[model samples]
Target: MGSKLGYVYRVLKLGGSLITNKNVPFSFNEELVTNVVNVIKNFKVILVHGGGSFGHYEASLSKENTQTRTVIAMQELNLKILKIFNKENIPVFPLPGRYFTINQVLEILQNNLIPIIYGDILPNGNIISGDDITLTIAKHFHTEALFATDVEGIIINNTAVSLLKSLDDFREIRTSQFDVTGGIREKLRKIFQYKVNSLIFDGRNPTNIYYALSGKRIGTFVEAE
Candidate 1:
């Protein structure tokens, strides 16, 4: 409640696995994205999204020495998302994640415009992961971070680790996907840098998105103490 622009602010990320058919290239889940947007538009939040099939596949190809094409593909995917939010009247302003200065983001928030950014193609010919961007925003804003993923949150010993205190908490969980960026392990490490407690929840069900943002504990909260 510090600024009239943001009554309740949060740095939120929409995982690519939930917004797109990850196994298929260029598959955008418009329906699911729209549904999630409907619920999230009710709050004052900065939106960050991963490039699932869009960005990851490019990153993989670029790893083999084809970089420029990868950057273009990532930009294309970013535009697609920007259009989706704009069409819905979400009051979104788009920016490439790598070049997104904290001052720019804050100015947008100050003016009450929801900034929609994504892991973009940086000028240095590199790609930044959406999760990494979320971590940065969390630290800068000193606010809570939330990630919407495909699973039911970080699982351990056949149960969700409701309160993750350290990286050792996820020692045994295996990732079974073609992840170009570091998977869950990387996500855990990023949030830990600032000892920021973040909320990880399932985005497959739109209701879960609503519940977690409403602070009702529908998902696992990573404790960063």
Candidate 2:
């Protein structure tokens, strides 16, 4: 691991769709999120989460005060996740995705605190996806990551490839109607651009989260090459 903290380190992104029911506005997948939180409590990694039903739903409907509404929704979901981690005795600190610096994350990690961030609308009102934040942090840390999503992985012709060699391998896939940030397509573009080797796996199964974090090869591995 490239972390100076000297441990098995990685960034983990919890896909919004995995943690919430996108079709149902403000619906949270509490059981799934709780299970994931429990399984990941022992690991030392930075966590990023998407807007899912929370921010996405608000963003889709609110034409006025879009940024404020969106960020507030995202904060609500973020706090719910923090509560779960706290219940597990996991030392998690919530950080704003828009303004959090790399040094802040490093300092938190040095103190053995899990820094959790989520996708949000910037001050300029641009929607930043959790995938983008995950890749950015992973690049700075020079480490691979686990992208936990609702799907098994990148699927083409109804199957998830074990290895994604290039963006050319991708095909159009369905994304949540309320998703303001680009979905899988945007994620793959960032992955390829940053050249951060990462895994895209199903988070619906609680065991898969454990397998991915533990580096057990449970899903599609997007190659850095």
TM-score of each candidate structure, all chains considered together = 0.89, 0.95
Q: How accurate locally, in lDDT, is each candidate?
A: 0.77, 0.86
Candidate No. with top lDDT: 2
> Which residues of candidate 2, in runs, are more than 4 Å off?
none
Count of clashing residue pairs in every prediction? 0, 0
Decoy 2 TM-score against native: 0.95
lDDT of 2 by residue, 1-225 (tens): 656677767789999889999889999998889899988887777999989999989988858998889889999999999999988888988887886778878887888899898888888888877887898888887778789988998897899988898888588778788877777887888889888999999999989988888877777999974
Q: Residue 143 of model 2: what lDDT?
A: 76
Q: What is the lDDT of residue 50 in candidate 1?
A: 86
Clashing pairs in 2: none
